[model samples]
Target: RDRIKTSINISGVLFHFVDTAGIRETNDAIEKIGIERSKQEISNADIVLQILDVTSLNDEDHKKLDDLLHTIKKEDVPVIRVFNKSDLLDSSQHSISIVSRETVISTSAVTGAGLQELKNALIKLSGVTDNYSVYSARERHLNLLKAASLHLNQASDFIKSNNPQLELFAEELRESSDNLGEIIGKTTSDDLLGKIFSGFCIGK
Candidate 1:
């Protein structure tokens, strides 16, 4: 229920939000799977939105939040503490301070309140610029490029050696080419075969 029904677009940056099942000790088989998935998402998340029931806040919940915060801190992820059901809270119960460093927002899902503030907080925390580009580069692309660079560096070292091992040098060059090819959605063997069938020299 915590998940947003749709993706939010702010200043041309698209934000995809995922709602996770409450993480707690449960013996239910399906619940355990969901908890595991939630943990996985937390580890990979750029930002985490932790929703809390304003009316049911208790000591046990605070202790759990602290533990979760500790784990999140180790990964250097930012978390926003959202107190839901604000419409039900009495005036005197409004001044609860859970975490000093985190961004806290009082929200009423039924009244459509505090939604704008949440969106604004997300935009600020994401560091989205007015001219943000919609480039398609992902983590895998950078990893592939890094691998290619490493192979090329090895090939360079072979070249600089007093007695260069031509076979090893060629192997490194091939590996580099393979890595580079993967970035462009090609495979080294496929590219080589194509060239060979097209009347081009294998060495070329």
Candidate 2:
């Protein structure tokens, strides 16, 4: 399939981009493949960009729009609805009702209109705030958390028993504290530290 190529790079993270063929009414194999691939991509994506044609978001495209929303919502991924080709709409004469309370940006891809606003909207939707400090969290930390959670559950069960073992509960509490400490680098292993620092840029 000779489809258009699209790529996106965020800071230093590279992501694969998939561009699907435009929706068509025909029952051709190519169109079917395109639809299937598009669905797959939407399901796997961390975020869904539901692009709407600003000039055609009426009854004609309502069913398709509803279907797209339904498909994306199945995976519980956050969606940023884009009203593209907004320049074609007469803002002074006509008004479109956006169902969502969140700001829906009007974009004209051809003229770079609203691109910055779109980017900002996407960044905000991603839930990464500027005030947050970046830190590397490894699988080890997740494992420790899981283990601690399990121990805590066990401790709770023991406390509910008629003959509770106080020493065992105390040991479990200590283990949970140790696990939490590792997450904040208070009790991290040398190997973990080496792996984390090795992945960092040389200048850092």
What is the per-residue lDDT of model 1 for residues 1-204, given as tens digits with 9 covering 90 to 100?
132234556654467677888878889888888877777677777887889899987667656656765775643677788889999988898787775577889999999888889988998888765565433245676788899899889989986899765556667777888887665655575564455345522343
lDDT for 53 (candidate 2): 86
Model 2, stretches more than 4 Å misplaced? 1-5, 10-16, 22-25, 59-65, 68-75, 101-103, 133-204
Checking candidate 1 for backbone clashes, the offending pairs are: none
Residue-level lDDT tens digits of model 2 in 43-126: 676666667788777654545645675756753556666789877867672456767633567788888888888777666765
Q: Per-candidate RMSD vs. true structure?
A: 10.8, 13.6
Residue pairs whose backbone atoms clash in candidate 2: none
Please give the distance, in angstroms, between residue 160's alpha carbon in candidate 2 and its true position after superposition.
Answer: 68
Cα-based TM-score, every candidate: 0.57, 0.53
Quote the lDDT for 4 in model 2. 50
lDDT at 73, model 2: 71
Q: After TM-score superposition, what is the CA distance of residue 5 in candidate 2 from its true location, in Å?
A: 5.4
lDDT of 1 at 193: 43
